[model samples]
Target: MNYLNKLERKIGKYAIPNLSLWLVVTYALGYLMMYMTPGIISYLMLEPAMVLRGQVWRLVTWVLIPPSTGNIFFYIIMIMLYYSLGTALERTWGTFRFNVYIFGGMIFTVIGAFVAYGFLSVTGGLTIGIGYYVTTYYINMAIFLAFAVCFPNMQILLWFIIPVRMKWMAYVYAALTIYDFVTTGAVGRISIAAALLNFLIFYLSTRNYQRVSPKEVHRKYVFKTQMRDAEMRHSGGVTKHKCAVCGRTEKDDPTLEFRFCSKCDGNYEYCQDHLFTHEHIKRS
Candidate 1:
């Protein structure tokens, strides 16, 4: 993270702002184009074979491929969900880090496609041939997975009723992605691996694997809640006098006496136990 901070200081000025919103708009345009002219996606797919044959446009155009072929309602919902996730990530990680995550995934996906083509060419088997499998589908899914890892405690309303934590959803997503990889041919496995490689790298970079565990998250949550509750009680004036040493107040021990020290430089107050034994406060 310190290294990232130094890198950000050097090149953060060049990062694109609101990059996620632009990506969502591009996806919307892609969906619209698909709706208007069916079968147009055949030309936009990430086909390394075609790229090698001089169709270089396929490299960048493949991002226009919509992740889902559902109806308009479903498209709208998917767009909304991804837009929220992407924007939240941008806000949390800043534009530079978010740019690295998304574009790194795309670059890895392209590399994976070429690797698939090379493997198929050598084997002469050509299983699936890396046609449409290397699309932005898994890349988009990786964005959601990254979000879940970042905000594990965040809750989402499932079907507008059941509340689910982001961490649980992340687990489910990982399971489904793994299942898809195993059931499909080697091409699918390579594509999934490439698409999710960015997420894996980013997750490891955080060094927060243990922090996301259920027990650790719960313990942190409890500690934060206790501190907040104590602050609220103090702010509400429930405890008028407090011992500086033990951080307790009249509310905790009404029988204890508190007094300001005359010899101390400032208005240092202490309870009976610490009033005589504590060192006197002094201005440096």
Candidate 2:
């Protein structure tokens, strides 16, 4: 993580903000193109053989191939989900880190495709079916899994009725991915490994396993809820001027001035002391 931090300091200036938004837009456009001309996707597949044969655009153009296509409702939901998760990760990790994580995954995926190509080419001449295994499906799944790790306690209304925690769903996703890997052929396994290698490296290096435990999440939830309830009760259910950093209200410190930070992404109030010293939060 320290090494990554140093790297970020060196190249963070080149980071593209709202990168996920552009990615989502690209997916949408790709889907539109698919609908308009189904044959167009063949030209965009990640085919190293084709690239070696002079179709070099396939290397980058494959990103335009949407992961899946079926029901309109589900497609919209999938796009929105990735957009939300990607944006949240961008906000949490800062633009440079998020960019590195995403682009690193892409680079690993490309390496996986080339590795599979080499293995296949050595055994038999280049096969026509290899690129079918390489797609954006696993890459998007990695993004979703990373978000679940970072915000495990966050809940989603499954089917707009049943409340489900992100961690539980992530576990289910992991199980399904594992099952696919175990049951699939070597090509599929290699593809999956290549796709997920970035996530494995990213999480293993930076994850604070202790903080993600159920007990820690529950304790923080309870403490914050109780503090909020106490503040509400103290203010007769009309609270205002609360400090974002310490959760201190004007009632707690009558003399402490409160000010809203202009640099923070959202509306964040800070106490007089922290007003100048608190870390600025920016959402991209």
Model 1: per-residue Cα lDDT over 1-284, one tens digit each: 78778988999899888888888888888888888997888888888888888999999988887788788888888888998999999999999999888999999999999888888889896634487788788988999999998899999998779999999999999999989999998888999999999999988887857878999999999999999999997789656688889988888878989999898998878999999999888888
Model 1 stretches astray by more than 4 angstroms: 127-129, 208-284
Per-candidate TM-scores read: 0.71, 0.72
lDDT of each: 0.88, 0.89
Off by over 4 Å in 2: 207-284
Q: Put down candidate 2 lDDT per residue, 1-284, tens digits, no spaces.
A: 88888998898899999989988988899899999999988898888889899999988988887778888798888888899999999999899999988898889989898888888888885556677888888989999889998999999988789999999999999999999999997778989999999899987987578788999999999999999989878868455788888988878878889999998999999999899999999876
Go through the candidates in order and give the clash count of each: 0, 0
Output the worst ten-in-a-row residue range by lDDT, candidate 2. 122-131
Error of 1 at 40 (Å): 1.2
Indicate the worst ten consecutive residues by lDDT in candidate 1: 125-134
